[model samples]
Target: MDQRVTIEIIDGVADVRLVRADKMNALDNAMFDGLVEAGETLKLNKQVRCVVLSGEGRAFCAGLDASNFGRMAGGGGGGEPENATSRLGPRTHGISNRAQYAVWVWRELEVPVIAAVHGFAYGGGFQLMLGADMRYVTPDARLSILEIKWGLVPDMAGTQLMRHLVREDLVRELTYTGRIFSGAEAQQMGFATRVCDDPRAEALKVAREIAGKSPDAIRAAKRIYNAANYRSAADGLMDESIEQSSLIGSPNQVEAVKANLEQRAPRFAD
Candidate 1:
C-alpha cells in the first residue's frame, strides 16, 4: 500500500493520499489494490469521522497508467488467457468487479469522503473522485471522461455517479467527446463542490469542520442523503424518520444539543 497510497489519521479525520508521484498517481494494479485496502481499513475505523483524499504529485491522477495502453495496443498484457474471462465476469465484491470496487468503496464507506483535486483528473481518475461525497478542485485543474479516446467506456462507476451530478445530455456529450474541462467549468456543470486556489488546504479545512460534528449525526446524514439518491421518495422519507429515531436521545445526540446550548464544543464518543 505504501507504494501507491498512504493514510494518516489525525483529529478524527483520515487523510488518504495517492502517492505514485512519478506516474502522476495513475492507477496500475498495485494502485488499485492499495486504494481498496485503504478504503477498507478506514471503513472499519469508527474513530474516523471524515476522510480527505488527495494525490501527491503534478496531477490528481492521469487515469489508467500509460503502460495499460501499451499492453492493449500490443495485445499481450491481458493476463494469462484462462484467468481473463473469469476476472471480467465475476462479481467478486457484491455488485462490483475488482477495478470498480477500487472506486466504489469510498461511496460505501460510512464516513463522508472529500476529494481534493489539483492539476488533472482524467478518465478513471475522474470516476474515483466521483465516489467522494464532496470535491474541492483548483481552478486550473483539468478533468475529462476520457475512455472514449481509447475506444472504451467509463467502466469505473462513471455512468452511475455521473447521472447523479451531471445532466444526461452533458454526460453524453463529455463521454462521447472525451473533452477536458477546467475546474471552474466543472463547478458550473455541478461536478465540483468548490473551486479554490489551493484545493488540498481548502478540502482539509472543510474535512476538519465535518470531523467536529457529532459522528452519529454525520453518519446518519450520509446514509439518509445517499438513500435519497437511490430510493423512492416514500422510502427516502421513511429512512429519514428511521435514522432520526436511532439518533434521538442517543449519547452523542444529547451531547450535540448540550454543547450548542452551552456554546461549547461537543465531546463525542467513538
Candidate 2:
C-alpha cells in the first residue's frame, strides 16, 4: 500500500501531500493516523517556516471512506472495538477527539499552512481545507459540505472553522444542503483565497514568499489571527501587544531590519 501521507521539506517549506490517489486520498483508518502523525511532526520542527498541503493525482480528498461508515454503522467508527466504543465523545487527543484532531491539528500548527486543492474537497476533506491559513483551488474544482447527504453533520471541527471563514447564514445554508459548489463559487463565497489553473504551484510560490519573512513574526501573526476568531477584542489587543513586544529587537527581527537596509535576503534562525 502507498503511504497515506508524505512530507518533504525544502527551504523552510514542508510539502505535505496526501498520497493515496487511488482512493481519492480518502480518510481510511490509516490515513487519519498518518495525517495526525504528520501534523505533530511538523508542529515540533522549528526548521519549518511554512507548509503547503496537497494531494497526489486526482482530487484533494473525497472525504471519509465508505468502509469507515460501515464501521460506524456497526456501532463503532474505528473498526477496532476499543476505539469504536466512543470514537468521537472521548478527548482522545488533547481537547479534541481523535477525528477532530486530524483536522484541528492544522489550526494548531504554529507556522502558516496553504492548501493546494484540485479535483474536489468534500465532507471531511472540505473541513481539512478550511484548516489552512490560505487555500488555492482550480477554477472548476468541485467542493461540498457533504456530511448531510450521508445522514451526518460536519463533525470534524468544520463547525468551528466555518464560523470564522464565512457568514453565519452561508454556513447554515451549506451545512443544511451539502450541495456541491465550484471553486469559482468558493472564491466568491470567501472559502478560497485564489482560483488558478495550477493551484499547487501557486501555493508553493506563496509558501516560499512566506518562508522568506521573519519566522518569529510570521508565527506571532498566525497566533493573533487564530485567537481573533474566539477571543474578546480586549484579549486580542493584549495578545498583539505581547507578541509585538517579544518580536521587537529579537535576533530574527533585527536581522530582518538589517537585511532590508542592506537589500539582502534575511537569514533567520530556525
Candidate 3:
C-alpha cells in the first residue's frame, strides 16, 4: 500500500493519492490493494468528513499496468498472474470481488468523495473515477472505456455506475468502440462534475468546504443521495426522514446552527 498509494488527513479531509507515477499510476496488484485499504480506512474513521482522490505525476491512471498485459501474453512479469475466472463466484467484500472493491468501496463510504483526474483515465481507472461522488478533471485529460481494446468487458463496477451517469446509447457506444474523449466532453456527457485547469487544487478546495459542514449532516446527505439511484421512492423518502431525525438536535447539528447564528465556523465533533 505504501509503494502504490498514500493517505494524508487534515482538518477532516483525507487526501488519497495514487503514487505509482512512473507508470502513470497504473493499477497493478499493489495499487488495487492500496486503493481498497485506503477506502476501508476512511470508511471506519468518522473524523474524515470528506475525501479527495488523485494521482501523482502526469496521469491520473492509465488503467491496468502494461505488465499485466505482458503476463497475459505468456511473458515474465513482476507478480503472480491473476486468474480472472477464479474471481467470479465469491463476494470477497460483501457485493464486490477484489478488483471491483478497489473502485466500489469509495461509493460505499458515507462521506463524499471527489476524484481529481488528469492526463489519462482509461479502462479500470475510468471505472474507479465513477466510484467517487463527483469528479474534477482537466479539460485536456483523456478518458475512455477501454476494455474492449483488450477484448474484455468492464468487470470493476463500470456497468453499474455508468448507467447512473450517462445515456444508454452513449454508454453502449463507448463500451463497444473504446474511443477516447476529452474531459470537457466528459462533463458535457455527465461523467465529470467540472473541468478545471488544476483539478487537484479545485477538488481540495471543494473538499475543504464540505469539511466545514456538520459531519453528521454531510454523511446523511451522501446516504440520501446514494439511495436515489438504488432505492424505491417510498423507501428513499422514508430513509430521508429517518436520517434527518437522527441528525436533528444532535451535537453537531446544534453546533452548526449556533455557528451560523453567531457568524463563526462551527466546531464539530467526529
Candidate 4:
C-alpha cells in the first residue's frame, strides 16, 4: 500500500502532504497513524521553522472512508472490542472521536502551519483545515460543513475554531444545513485567508516569508494570537503587555534590531 502521509524538510520548512490520493486522502486507521506520527515528529524537529500542509491529487480530502462508517454501523458506532479505537473512537454524530484528533493536532504545533486546500474539502476534511493557523484555498474549491447530511454534527474541533471565524448564526446555518460553498464564499465567511488558483504555491510563498523572519518573535506572536481567541479583552491586553515586555530585551530580539541596522541577516536560535 502507498504511504498515507509524506513529510519533506527543506530550508527549515517542513512540507507535509497527505499522500492517500486514491481515496481523496480520507481518514482511516493508517491515515490516522500517519497524521499523528507526522505531528509528533514535528514536535521534536527543532530545525523546522514553518510547515505547509496539503493533500495530493484531486481533492484535499473527502472526509472519513466509507469502510470506517460500515464498521461503525456494524459495531453500533463503536470499534472492535480489542482495539484502542473501541474505547476512544466511538462514532458520535457521524464523526468518530479519533477522527477529530486528525485536525486538533495541528493546533497543538508550536510553529505556524498553513493549509493549502484545493478541490473538494467536505465534512471532516473541512474541519481538518480549521486546525491550521491559516488556510489558502483554490477559488473553485468546494467546501462544506457536511456532517448534517450524514446525520451528524461537526464533532471534530469545528465547534471551537468556528467560534472565532464565524458568527453564531452562520455557524449554525452551515452546520445544520451541510451546505456546500465555494472557496471564495469561504473567504468571505472568514473560513479562508485567501482564494487563489494555486493555493499551495500561495501558502508556500507566505510560509517562506515567515521563515525568513525572527523565529522567536514569530512564535511569540502566534502564542499571543492564539490566546486572544479564547481570552477576555482585559486578559488579552495583559498577555500582550507581558509578551512585549519579554521580547524587548531578549538576545534574539536584540539581534533582530542589530541585523536591520547592520544590513546583515539575523541568525536565530531555536
Candidate 5:
C-alpha cells in the first residue's frame, strides 16, 4: 500500500488513515490508487471486523486537488483526462467510473465502513465519504457538492449514493447549486449520521463496539441494508433469504451462538 494511505489494525478494527496532511489528503491519482488498494486489502483480511476511515492532520479531505481542474480542462500535470480512455465492464464499482473509484471502493467492501470527517470534505472528498456505511462528522466540518463550481457534475457515484440518503429534490438542489454546508446541516439533511466534537474519536469508538459483535451477523446486516436500496421489496426479501441461507449453520454463526451462551470470546473460523 502507498504511504499516502496507512492501514493499522488494533484488535479487530482496521484504522485506515489518509496521510497526505500536506495537501489535506487531496485526491490525486496516487491517493486514489492508495485508497482502492486499502479497500482491496480489507477484502481478504479475515481478522478485520470493521474499519474506521479518517485523515491525519486537521482536515478529512479537501476534495479533488483543486489543481486537478486544470488537468481536466486539458492543461498540464494532473495527468491525462479521466475520460481519455474508455475500458469495458463496471468501471471500478457501480455508477463510478474508474476515475471515481478512489472513493467508491469503500462501498464494495463487505464489511461496514465508517468515515470520520472533519474540517473540509468538499467536492470529490464529500462524495468519497458517501461510500462509507456511516459518516461521523465534526460539527464544524465543511461539506459540499462543489463540482458545479467548476462547471462539472458529481461524477463519483455521488448522485447514486445521495439518492438513498437524502431527498431527491435536496440532492438536486445541492448538486446543482454546489452549496457548502456544515456538518450540523448535513446531519439534518441525512448526509451525516451524527456530528461530534471529535468525529474520529467517536467513529473509532463505534467501530470498536461493532468489532465486538458477531462478524457474520454484521456482514448479513450490511448486505440487507445495501439490498434494501438497490432492490424492490420482494427482491430484497429474497436477498435476505439467500444471505441468511449462507450464514445459517455456518461455523462462524454457530460459534457466535456458542460464545453468547458461554459469555466468552468467539473463536470464529476464517
Candidate 6:
C-alpha cells in the first residue's frame, strides 16, 4: 500500500518491487513500512502462491539510507529518526520490530519468496536478500554484510537469517569485516541460490514454475521447511505426515493427479 513498495499479482505469483531507484532502493522507515505492508497484504491473499521480489533501478537495495547512519549514532539533526520514541526491542510485528519485519516478512509468507538481486545488495540490503527462500543474483552484483563498515551490526534479522544460509565462521568473518563480495562468490559461499546474467528473468521463470503447482502443496512445503530448521527429526517427520494427511484426497491434490493423468493443465482453487 505504501508508495515506496508496490505489489502486483498475476496468476498465482506476486511480483513485489522496491521502487526507490533514486536512492538505489535504500531502506528508510518508510521503505521498511512499505515492505512490511506489502508482505502482510499478500499473506492474507490465498491466491498468492509465490512471490518474486526485486528492486527497480540500478541496484536491488543499497542498505540503510546513508542519512540514517548519522542519526543511528545520535548525531544527525536534520531528519526525524524512524520514530525516535520507538525502541527496537519490542516485537512490533510478530517477533520482529518494523524494520526487521521488512526482511522477516518474506520468511513468514506461506509461499516461497524469491529474490532477484542485481547491482549491489549492501548492509541491510544483503540481509534483505537472506529473507527470501531463494536468491537469484547477477554474477557481478555486489553483496556484503555491511554493518561492520559503520561499526554496527546487521540488526535487521541478518544474524538469524545468515546462520541458516552460511557457516558460522563465514558469517563471523563477513559480519566482522563488512567487505563486499560478488554474487558468483555468494553462490559458492551459499548466500545465493544462483548467479545469472539476468537474475530477474530467471527468478520469474522459477516463480512461474512454482506458481503452477498446487497451492496447498506449496504452502505446506514452505511450512514444513521453515519448521525443519529448528525442530527435531521426529517432529519434522510428524509434520510431514500431518501435512500429507491433510493434502491426501484434497480437491487440489486430486486435481493435480487428474491433470497429470489427463495430460492437461490443472485448474487449482485458491
Best by TM-score: 1
TM-scores of the candidates in the order shown: 0.83, 0.81, 0.82, 0.78, 0.80, 0.81
Q: Pairs clashing in candidate 1? A: none
Clashes of each: 0, 0, 0, 0, 0, 0
**TM-score ranking from best to worst?**
1, 3, 2, 6, 5, 4
* Candidate 1 CA-lDDT value: 0.81
Clashing pairs in 2: none
The list of candidate 5 runs beyond 4 A from truth reads 75-96, 231-270
Between the candidate structures 1 and 5, which one is better when assessed by lDDT?
A: 1
* lDDT for each residue of candidate 3 in 1-270, tens digit (9 for 90 to 100): 768989999999999999999999999889999999999999999899999999999999999886665443331212333432333434677666777789879988999999999999999999999989999999999999986665355767777788889999999999989899999999999999999999999999999999999998988888888778754423332332334334334455455545544568768788
Go through the candidates in order and give each one's C-alpha lDDT: 0.81, 0.80, 0.81, 0.75, 0.77, 0.80
Q: Name the lDDT of candidate 4.
A: 0.75
Candidate 3, residue 136: Cα displacement in angstroms equals 0.5
lDDT of 1 at 260: 46
lDDT of 5 by residue, 1-270 (tens): 568899999989999999999999998878888898898889899899999999888789898875555543332223532332222123335444554566667876888899999999998889889989999998889999986555455666676678789999999999879889999999999999998998889988999999999999999998888777755433332332334334333455455545544568767676
Superposed by TM-score, candidate 3 places the C-alpha of residue 170 at a distance from the truth, in angstroms, of: 0.2
Error of 4 at 81 (Å): 4.9
Root-mean-square deviation per candidate: 17.9, 17.7, 17.9, 18.5, 17.6, 18.1
Any residue pairs clashing in model 6, and if so which? Answer: none
Better of 2 and 5 by lDDT: 2
Off by over 4 Å in 6: 73-86, 230-270
